[model samples]
Target: MIFILIVTLLIYAGLVFYVAWSGYRGIGIKGNRWFLIAYSIIMLFLSVSFILARFGSGSTLLAVIGNYWLALFSLSLMILPLVHLIMLILRLTSLHREKTRVAAARIAFVVLVAALAYGSYMAYTPKVNTYTIDIDKSYPEDLNVVMFSDTHFGYLSGKKHAERLVKEVNELEPDLIIIPGDIIDDDLEIVEKKQIFNILGGLEARLGVYGSLGNHDKFRGELSELITAIETANIEILYDETVTIEGGLALIGRKDYSEGERLATEQLTSQLDQSLPIILLDHQPYEYDEAEQAGVDLVVSGHTHRGQVMPGNLITNRLFENDWGYLKKGQLHTIVSSGYGFWGPPIRIGTQSEIVQIHINFNN
Candidate 1:
């Protein structure tokens, strides 16, 4: 973990320095010492603020600023590259280098700001994505399963966010609610102090709200405290357990992959009645073949966040077989949500926060 953090920091520092150099060149470095100094100070401050946040510095404002800056930095990484390419083409064509460079710099800055603003808006506005699937097994009626994952409820997602989510899910009138993981941010103090868990209790679902633990969900204080908090919210936390809902529909929730030595999917489903349809909830989207082999009708997950930012999804797409949407693998179906909240930065570029409402139609 320490090694990965160091490598990530190195890569981030390298990219930031490259972007800074490109910006300086784009603006034709002459008399730009002050600009360079200012930019350097801002980047340094943001970097330090982010590090402080990781170490529990406890300044919400600093953390928010740092995260927003991280989003802007990521946006710059994508937008500035194209600007540099344009500048290169203009320079090669001998089209007044100084003027082209300055224009490119101005355009890049404007584009970066616009992208950041748009992404921030996308992050806050939660969209409901509805998917209807036909189950090949017998059941009484259609099951309205509403799910949202990665609601890291701490500094970024506070009481208001929780309330909003509750209102939205209640409005959906779901028969069952499944939270695939990451109910809390890495800390439990803020969530408990603010009574965010109680606010989550407002969520009204007929079959009750159920959740599976994710990597982030396990990062905080006592596991018992987290479970108690979730239970207090009238939500059941399923840890490698199976429960048959009222209609004989079996719901299996697995411990997150980060939890170490979890029950195998096949082992979990070995003695289950397969004719009634089995739905499995696993936080991270991995090992699809195991779920398929285990006769899991549908698997829901959310750890990928579909990269949570632009080009990040491209990486996630390559990493997971089905990163964002629904995929049919033989007899099993999997749906991975982009998630309802942000992780590091409260920004969503090339992606939007979503609540997945799946309609399961059972054919007898």
Candidate 2:
């Protein structure tokens, strides 16, 4: 773990320096000493944040400040490319000479900053995306399932955020609510924060609230507190286990993807009654094939966050067959959310923050 942290810090520091270098090049170094000084100061803060955040600052205030530093650094990375693009366009069109090209670069910087600000606001405001599916078999009436993922509670959101989530889910009148994974941030201390457990416990679902662990949930390697928090919030944690709700629907929760076969999908479903509709909550969206072949009807996931930001989304799009939103295959269906909250950057660009409302109707 120490080695990984060291490597991460080095990479982050490199990124910070590169962003500063990009700004230097874009703005031209000829008479920009003040600009360079300002950039250097910013880089210093970002570097400090990298160390403090990665190495573990015991102070909550430092953590929050570090998040803002990371956000600014992230915005700079996006702005660099845009600045370059603007410079190139201006030079290509010859609409502006050298002076004009420089001005256009600044314009690009403003545009990206404005976009980052708007994206940050949207990151906190999760929208509800509803889906309705019909099963060919007969059963009790319809089941309203509200599923969300990637809350990253401590990192980007906390009590007030969870409170809003609870209110929103309740308003949807969901029969069941499942947080596929990533209910916690990378920090385990979030479980102790009054706001988190307090508001989460207030969540209302007709059947109940259920959760599966995500990579973030195990960040500290101690699950007891988080588990206790979940239980306190009236949420059942499906740790590589299955539960039947209302004696009709089967919900299976798989641990985070990295756990590597904590419970093989085949073994997990071999004894199940295939006639009943099964909902698999696999954190990483990886077990879809196993679920589909095992007679699992649907899979809900949220690890990808649909890339959360751009080019990143482009990579996630290629990584997962269904990186975000919904995908259907024969009798099997999958819905992957972009995530309710964000991680690292605290902004959502090229994707939406969402809560999923899936209305499942049984065919008689």
Candidate 3:
């Protein structure tokens, strides 16, 4: 935990320094003096808030003040990229004092604003992708599986977002819905009070909805509550459990890798009938090799969130074997979803939210 805190502090410090340098470059040293002082104060308050929030004492008056300070801090954070872009434009245009330079800066600013707005809209506007998988079985001929993950329901996403998610799932008319993990943020109680479960309850699937506990869900001490809430909403929580679908297909769910439990890959595979196709629901995508070796036919997961921001996706993709798309390991198919919600900033710089609808068909 101390290691995590230290790493987090280092990252935050790096961001502060980057912002300071960007502001200084954009506005000039003299003009940026006040901005630097204000940003420094915000950073200090933000650091304190981070520490307090960790201990769950971030709701008092001081915490409230800290929260506002962080909000302002975030506002400034949103402006940092713009500042850098402006500075770059200035540097390029300063060499040539042409009227075209002024026009170019205006155009660049307008383009950046439009891009940001469009990206935000895309992040909020969820997309549902339909897919088909062939698993020879004898029961339900036409089965629809709805998969959405990484909702991270807290400050950024709440009841409204849940409602939209429920609405989207209902539209798909799925036989079952699967939420791999990261459905809630560190603060699960906040989402519960927001009646997120009520919204989720409105979603209808033929068999039921099944989900696994994400790292964040376990961290918040709300795993049981979240499971109860979702179950009350008629969705089933399948933590370290297996259920047979109507067509004899096995659906096994494992808790997030970070959760204190055995990997469950071999155990889950050992319990399943090899003849029947097995679908494994895991939160992290890197476990594909294990699932493949265990003879799992398909694996579905979504913790990467496609970085939830730019450049991060590049890094995440490089780290994970199958980061944000479909990969076939021999006969096994693995699908890693970018997920359906934002994590921290609420602003998704690159990736958009998604709902994956999978259809399993029997070739034989």
Candidate 4:
């Protein structure tokens, strides 16, 4: 994992440098020393700002600038490549190379800005995605399960975001609310500083709020402390634990995959009555067949964020069987949320922040 991260950073740094140089040259401003210097400085700062923020710089200004710069940087990388391709195609025409470069550069800038604008709007707007599924098992009444993941409640998803989640979730009048994982961002202290827990405590659902520890949540604090904090907020944070809700169905929450060796799905469900419906919450979506074989009726997950941004989702789609949305294998139903909040940059392209609403209709 460390090696992969290092290689990814190197590749990212190289692409960023190439884009910075290409953009500067494309604008036909090579002769303006002052302009070049100013541009270089800004690019350099933006490039390293995220690293600074991640390393505990503890500056909101740096966090804002760095995170937003990441979004802009991603857009630039995507748009600049297409712009270059367009310019290359235009070389066949009568247009001069320099003029085409300048035109392409301007077009790229406009498109980048527009893409960022769209992505930012989508990121802030949380949508309720409803899914209705029929279960063969019999229950007294239908269950309205409202689930969302990856809130990352730090600088990006603070008070306002929590309030939005509570308000929207309550308005739905769900019987249950499930946060698969990633309730906190990277820092646990930020939750207290922002009074995010107080706001999240406002969440109203009949079954109450329940969540499992995500990979990000694992990094925030000690397992016991994090679980206590979440439970104190009226959320039940399960760790390799199973509970019988209303003595009707069983819900199992597993430790994250990064937690070394967690319990297997079949092992966790072995003791539970096979007749009762079973739901599992595993942060990262993996080993679907195991869940299905274990007689798990449903599984919820939220790690991928469905590529959170354009082209990023394209990669995630290939990595997981069901990166986002619902997938059923045999009798098991899996729903992977794209996430309610973002990671590095508070922006999402080709995807929107979502809360999943699964209306389970059991056979009478």
Clashes of each: 0, 0, 2, 0
Among these predicted structures, which one has the highest TM-score? Answer: 4
Quick one: best lDDT, which candidate? 4
lDDT, candidate 2, 165-283, per-residue tens: 98998999888999899887777665465468777888888889998999878656567767877678788999999988885788888878887758877766765777888888988
Q: What is the C-alpha lDDT of each candidate?
A: 0.86, 0.81, 0.74, 0.88
lDDT of 2: 0.81
- In candidate 4, residue 162 scores what lDDT? 91
Reference-based lDDT, residue 307, model 4:
97
Model 4 CA deviation exceeding 4 Å by range: 1-6
lDDT for predicted candidate 3 compared with the true structure:
0.74
State each model's C-alpha RMSD to the native: 2.4, 3.1, 4.4, 1.9
